[model samples]
Target: MKNIVAAVLAGVLSLSLTGCSVFQTLEGQTEDKPNEYSNVYELSSGKAYVWEHDGETDIRNDLSQDRVGDPVFFACPLGDINFKGDELSDIDQYPRSIWIPSDIDDQIPTVTSKNALIYISDTTVPEEIIFERFADYGYSIGVSNMEADGGGHYFITYAETDEDDYKYYVDMKSEAAQVTEFDTIARLYLDKVGGMEVNEDTVSDGGTVMNLEKDKSYICEFYTGTFYQDFKLKANIHSFGKLERFVCHDYEFLHANCIKIEIPDWFKSGYYFVQGVGLFRYVTDEDLLSYNGKAFDPGINWNDPIKQYDEYGVCIFDPSLDIDYEDIENISDPGLDESEIVIGASPEEEEETEGSEIDESSEGSTLDSDSN
Candidate 1:
C-alpha cells in the first residue's frame, strides 16, 4: 500500500491517492504544516496532494496564456510512521489502487518500461539523491527553467538530450535547480514517467500475496470505486497451516465474496504475493460499465520475484476474531482463477494445458497489485 510517509522514505516522488473512494485531501492544518513550504496549506499524514490558490497567482497555465502565483507544494514529513484517527480502522484506510510495498534495493537490478521511480525535491538539495534513488532504473532525468511571478526563479522547461531523454524538476521559489513532487491542478500536469507506452496492456487482472503461518487466521481488505471490501481467510495447523491461495480478477479492485485461498503444492507455504495486472489508467465506475474485455495489460507471474509487503499490512493474530475459511468462503463471492496463468506471457507460455483459460465470471476478478 502507498502511504504518505512510506513513499517519502522510499524516495519515490510520484504518487496517487485513493480514487473516487476515500479521496479526501487535507486542506487546513495551519499549526501542523512546516514553515519551510511557506505554510500555504497542509495535509494530514503527509500525503502528496496537489492544490491551487486564487485565479491571480504567479502560476502560468501552459494550456493557456494565463498568469497567477506559483502553486503550493506541501513539504510533508519524511520519516513519519503514525496512522491518525480514521486510518486506525481497516474500513477507513485510504484505498491504494496498487498495494505493493515500496521497495528500492542498493543495486539496480533491471529497469523496464513497466514502471519508473520518480523523485522530486521541494528545497534545493544535492543531485546525488536523484542518482542514488532513481537514475539507474534506466530513467533519464534532467531539470529545466521556468519563470516565477516574483523575483524568485521558476524553472519549468523540457530540454531533451540524446543520452538522458527525460525531465525531472520544476520549481516556484527557484534559487537554482528545483524539483517537485506536486503538480498544479490547473497548470501543466505531468503524470506517468519515462517512455513507457501506456495502452490496454497496462490494464489487466489483479491479485496480492502475504506471508502467513498455519494455525492463524487473517482479515483482508480490497477497495475500489468507493467500495471497501473486507473478508476473512484462515488456516489451521492441518491442511491449512497458512495456505497460500491466488485469486484472479477481471479488473483491478473488483469486489469478492468470502472465498478462501486454496494453496497447492508448487505454490508453497511461505509468504504468497498474488496480483492480477497493472492498469495505467484510473478506472472509474463509468469506465467499468463500458468495458468490453478488450482493455488490460496482462502482467507478470505472481511468483516471479517472491514475497510482497505493504504498510497497510496483513491482518492476523487478533484474539477478538472468530472465522473459518469455509465459513468465509460461503460469505465471500466466488473468486477468479486461482492459478498463475498470465496474459502477457509469450504465446508458447499461454499454450500450457493447465490454468489456461481465464475465469471472467467472478465479480471480484481484478486488483491493483504492486509486486516488487
Candidate 2:
C-alpha cells in the first residue's frame, strides 16, 4: 500500500511540472509581443514623457528647458515636433507662412494664399562654406535683394540645391518668416518631385520623418501654422534613390522677401546646354521671346522634345514620360517609318512575325513547284 501511494504521488508531481512548463511557454510568448507605443511621447505643461505600458507618466522633469524658447518649438506642438532637448521655447526660428504663384505650366496650381511659417537661423557652419556646397551640388545663388513689407524690411535669398532642383526663396525678415518660407519651399519641391498631392484640409503642424523601411522613408510636417492646427506637407523623395525632396508653401515670400530666384526647370535642363553659361542672362531667356540678341530665338530647340507640354504649353520633366531611345530617335527624325520602329513590342508579336515569314516562304516555294 505504501508503494502504491508513492507511485500516485510521483504521477501528481509530474503532471504539475508539465502544467508549469505550458504556463511558462504562454508567458514567454506574451513577453515577446511587440509594443505599439514604442515611438510615441507626451507632454503636459513643460514636462515631457516617453509612453510605456502604464500610460503617460513623467519620465524626467529635470530635462533642460532651453528648447522651449526656440520659435520653431513654439510654433509646433510638443509631441508633433521632435527635438533633442526638453525646453519647448528654445527651438530654431523658422517661418510660419508663405505665398506661391497661382499657376505654373504642367505643374499643379501654385499656392497663392498665405499659409506658412519661416525661421532664419545661422547653421553650425559658415555662410561661405554653405554657399559653396550649394553651388557644387548644381545649385547657384543668383542675387540678394531686400524689400519693405508689413511695416518691416524683409530680405530674400535664392539657392539651387540639386541637378533638377526647384527654386528656394528665403525670407530674412524675421526668424518666423524665414523658417516658414524654407519649410514651405522644401515641402512644395518635395510634392512636385514625388508626385504626391497635399490634402490642404488634413495638413498639420510639426515635422515628422517616418521610417517606412530600413532604407525607405518619408517626411511629414506642418509647413504652416502651429503644430496642432496647421497645413501638413509630406514628401517621399527617398523612394526614387537619386532625387531630393523639395517643399515650399508661399510664393509672395519669394517675390516680396526673396533676394534671389533659382532658374525654372525648363531653362536648366532644356535651355541651359543650348545657350551659353551666363547666369543673369539666362534669367531673362523666356521661351516666347523673339530671336533678337536681347531675347531667345523662337525657332531654336527651346522646348523639350521628350516631355508632354502643360496647360500653359510648357514641357514637363517627369521621368514617367521617358520613352525608348530608339522611339525618341524615330520621333525626332521625320524620314523614319513609324511602323518599323521596334519600341516596347511584345514577345507574342515577335513570334507571329517569324511564323508569318515562314508561311510566306513556304507558299512561294509551293507556287514555284506548281509552275514547274
Candidate 3:
C-alpha cells in the first residue's frame, strides 16, 4: 500500500511540471509573434520608418505611378525635397504607397485639407480588421512628419482618389523618438512660462496644455513668418485665468514698421497660476528694461491702446484678449503711454548716442508715437 501511494504522488508531480513548462512556452510564443512582424527602415535622407504588422500580406514592389498597393511617403519640404530610393539599404525597401483597407464601408479614404479636422472611421477599428479589409486592398498611403509619444504616434495620411480629390487620414501607432523630442521642447517652454513641474511621468497631461498653446503660437508664428515679413517678439505676458497676451513688432530699416500680434487674453490661465508679478519679474529678470537707449517700466500695464496703421492691416490687439475677465473692463480701450514706451535702438544708434553725451531721459521718449 505504501509503494502504491508513493507512485501516485510522483506521477502527480511530473504532470504539474509539464503543465508549467507548456504555459511558459505558449506565453513566449505569443509575445514573439508581434516582435517578428515589427520592422524599422531608415532612408538615406536622415528619415526613419517604423512599422508593425497587423497580420497582412508582406510584399514589396515599386508602383510609383500606378497608385495601386504602392507605398506612399510624406515629409516636410523644409529641408531636402528629393527622394533617393537607390540609397535605401533595405532589401524590402519600396517606393511609398497608399494603403486602403478592403473592408472600409466607404471604399475610399476620407480626406480633408483643414488642419483642425480629424479622420476617425478607419482608425477606430481593430488592427486585424483594418489589415484584413484595408491592407489586402492596394491602397498605399503617404504621410509627413509623423510624431509619437507616450500617447501614441500620429501620421497624416494622404491618398489620391479617382475623383482627383485627396483624402486625408491620421495613422497612429506606438510612440517613437521624434514625438518625445517635441514633447520635451514643449515642456521646457511651459516650465519657462508657468514654472510647472513636469517630467516624463506627468508630461502627458501637463504637456498637453502646453502643446495646445504652443500649437496656436506655432500657427500664428508661421503666418507671421510668411505674411508679416520680418516680425519679432516684442513683449509677451502670460497670466493665470484668461489674462495672457503676447506682442510682436515688425521692423524695417531704422523704423518700427508694424505691430503684428497682440493676444488679448489667454484661455488656459485657470489651469495654472500666473501672477502679474511673474510677468513683471520676467521683464526685470531678463533685464529687458534696457534694450538700446530706452527703458521699460515693469510697474505699468503692458497692454497697448494705440491702433497703429500698417500697410497690410490695422495694427490692433488680438480679439482673444477679451477672454480675461479680471482686468478686461480696465483694458477695454487702453492707450499706449508714450512715456512708458521703449524703442529698440540699433548698434549704430547706440554708438551715436553714447558719443554725444545726450540725456538718457530725452532718448527714452524719442519713440515715434504717431498712430499712423
Candidate 4:
C-alpha cells in the first residue's frame, strides 16, 4: 500500500509541474507577440501590418489572414472633414484635445502640418474610450532626463502600475479620424496646472522638468515668474546642456461633467475652498491674437468641443520679457501629475516687486484633491 501511494503522489507532482511549464510557455508567447507601437496615421495602407521595427515593411500586406478571430484595434473616424489648405484647425475638423508623450519616437511625429487630422482607417472610436482604456490599465506616464543614455534620453515614459507583472498599458495604434489636405502644424492644450503666473518661490507639483528630482542641476527653463501670481507650469524635457526638447505639459484636465460649486456669500472672510475648479491656463500670444479679446476660456464641451483647445482656451495675460508656459519643455514635476492640482488664487495679484512669491494663493481654491 505504501508503494502504491508513493506512485500516485509522484504522478500528481509530475502533472502539476507540467501544467506550470505549459502556463509559463503560454505567457512568454503572449509577451513576445510582436509588440508594436504605431500612430493611427502611420498605418498608411489603412491596415495593421506586421510591424517589427521603426521602419517596418508596408502594413497593407500585414493583414492577418488566419488571425481574423483576433480582435483588431481600430480608430473610428469622427466629425469627418476634408481640409484643403496648409493650416487646419478643429474649426475644420474634430475640436478636442490630444496629448502625446515628449519622448515619442521622432519617426512617430506629433501633430504636424501633414497628418494631424488624418486617420488610418474608417473604424474609429471616441477619445473617451481611449482614455478609459488608459485608466483601466492603471497606466502611469513618467518624464525624467536620466543622467545616462549619452544625454537626450529624456523619454515620455510609459509603464503599467503593476511593477511585478505589468501585462498591459496604452499602446498607440491606428485610429480613424478626419483627413484632409489642410494640416494642423502645431497643437496646444491645457492639462493639470495652467495659471497666469508661477512665482519663483512656488514649488511645482512636478510640472517643470527642472523641478522633477531635487538632485538635478537647476537651469530654470520655464519657472521664471516672480513677484505676485499668474504664471503656470508647462512641459517637461531633457537637457544635457543643449536646447530643450518638448515633452509634455500639464493643463487643467477634467472628464465628462464637473460637480457644481456654489460659494457662500456670507463666507468670504477667511479661508474658503472651492471644490469645483483650480488653476487657469497661462496667457500666451496666441490668446491675445484671438478675434475675441477674452483671455483663454476654461470651459469644457461636455461631449464634443468645437475647435482646437476650444474648452481650455489660451490665457489673456500680456506678454513680457518673462518666459511663457510654452517655452517650458519635457522636464517632469511630480507635483503636476494630476490635472486637479490646485493653485492659491487671490482676487488680487501677489506682489512680485521683490522677487518670486510662494504659492500663497490663500483665498484661491484649496487643494480639493477629493474632487479628482
Using lDDT as the measure, the top candidate is 2
**C-alpha-based local distance difference test score of model 4:** 0.22
lDDT of each: 0.23, 0.25, 0.22, 0.22
Model 1 Cα lDDT, one tens digit per residue, 233-347: 3322111011122232212111211111122222211222121111112122333345332212122111221222111121221111322233423433345232432322322
Global fold similarity of model 1 (TM-score) = 0.19
Residue-level lDDT for 114 in candidate 4 = 14
lDDT of 2 by residue, 176-283 (tens): 122333333212211211222322222121111122222222232222222322222222111100011112222122221111112233322121110110111122
> Ten-residue segment with the worst summed lDDT in candidate 2?
129-138
Comparing 2 with 3 on lDDT, the higher-scoring candidate is: 2
Evaluate model 3: give its TM-score: 0.14
Better of 2 and 4 by lDDT: 2
Predicted structure with the largest TM-score when compared to the true one? 4
lDDT string, candidate 3, 1-372, tens digits:
999999978877786867755455556774311111111121122221121122332212211122233223211111111122322222212222122122221211111111010111212221210000001111111112222335442222122232211111111221111122221111111111122232333232101212123112211111111232111211111111111222322111211111111112221111111111001111121223442211122233322222221221222333332322244235433553433222322234445655665566556556544332
CA lDDT for candidate 3: 0.22
- The alpha-carbon deviation from the true structure for residue 333 of candidate 3, after best TM-score superposition, in angstroms, is 7.2
What is the descending TM-score order? 4, 1, 2, 3
Pairwise TM-score winner, candidates 1 and 2: 1
Residue 321's lDDT within candidate 3 is 26
Q: Any runs in candidate 2 off by more than 4 Å, and if so which? A: 1-372
